[model samples]
Target: MAKLDVELKVNGEDYKLQVGSQERLLDTIREQLKLTGTKEGCSVGECGACTVIVDDQAVNSCMVLTAQVDGSKIITVEGLESKSGLHPLQKAFIEKQAVQCGFCTPGMLMSALALLNTNPEPSKEEIKTALEGNLCRCTGYQQIIDAVEMAAEEWGG
Candidate 1:
């Protein structure tokens, strides 16, 4: 099989990579770029564990081909932190104790980040709708919703 060249700006960094034709964006981000914060739970996109921001939209990395998103900007869970510190969403998650078992936190954060980036002050229903794609077995989702609400407050203020 031939490889396809792709250019992606991920987590504020640019990368030029040659990837397999069948390679998923999740694999490229995890293997080539070494960004493991994006998890692969259900490869068919049913589970949002591999959620990431691509071109300002929240998408399941497992569902996208690296070649499909050539020249796009992407943000994974690792991108949430900066020189200043953890993002407000991250801090809110911790403060609200939204993490448990830790498997779904990355996807949750990414989804929430995508929402907050666009909405900044989403209502509870909007937050629920934004996060509906993501699944969490722990924390009961109430905390996650609360965390998103808290982040929205902090983000708006």
Candidate 2:
């Protein structure tokens, strides 16, 4: 396969990489850019474990080809923290014990981040809808929803 030249802005950093045309976005982010924060659950896109924010929308990385997202801005779980402190959602997740096994965390965080970015004060139903694509075998969704609610409060949503 021929390698294609591409540039992606991820987590506020720009990267120029040579990617194959058949490369999935998940593999490109994880293997090429070394953003291991994006997990790979079901490559078929049913699990939502490879979720990332592309231009403020939560999308399954496995569902997109790296070539399809040229020049796009992406945000993975690694981007959630800053020098000041952990993001409000991260704090809430830790306090509420919403993470388990840790495989689903990155995707969950990305989905939640997208939700908050769009609707800071999302109702329970909205939260549920936002995370419907993400599957977490551990940590029942109640705690996750609670954590999102708490973050909304902290972020003044």
Candidate 3:
């Protein structure tokens, strides 16, 4: 196997790395970039635990090859917050008590972020559709939905 040189912009930072052909974006983010905020629940794409934003769209990091996303801008859970303060989504998640166990929170947040980025005022059904891929065993999704709604009210900037 040969290593491919690639450049990726993640969390507003650009990185040039040598990646194997078989390396998944999830591995690149978690291992090479050390952004463990994107968890790997199932290597398969069924579990949204490895979700991240690639080129403004929410995608499963486990489903994409690192080489496939070369030169792409990606956003992980870490990217949602900044030095100024927590992103509105983060604040809403905490305020609404949307996190439990936290295994699925990162993916859920990423999905919600993608949706809100495109549609600041998404309907409840829209929120559900955006989060359809992410599975959460806790919270029953009501709090998460509420959190997204709350973030929409606070954000939209």
* Candidate 2 regions with alpha-carbon error over 4 angstroms: none
lDDT of 3 by residue, 17-89 (tens): 9999999999999999899999998889887989999999999999999999999999999998888999999
- 1-157: candidate 2 lDDT, tens digit per residue: 5799989999999999899988999999898888898999988988889999999999999999988999999999999999998999999999999987889988988999999999988999999999999999885788889999999989955
Tell me the spans in candidate 1 whose CA falls farther than 4 Å from its real position.
none
Candidate lDDT scores, in order, read: 0.93, 0.92, 0.93
Candidate 1 per-residue lDDT, tens place, 1-157, comes to 6789899999999999999999999999999988888999988988799999999999999998999999999999999999999899999999999998888999999999999988998999999999999999774699999999999999864
* Pick by TM-score: 1 or 3, better one: 1
- What C-alpha lDDT does candidate 3 achieve relative to the native structure? 0.93
TM-score of each: 0.97, 0.97, 0.96
Query: Pairs clashing in candidate 1?
Result: none
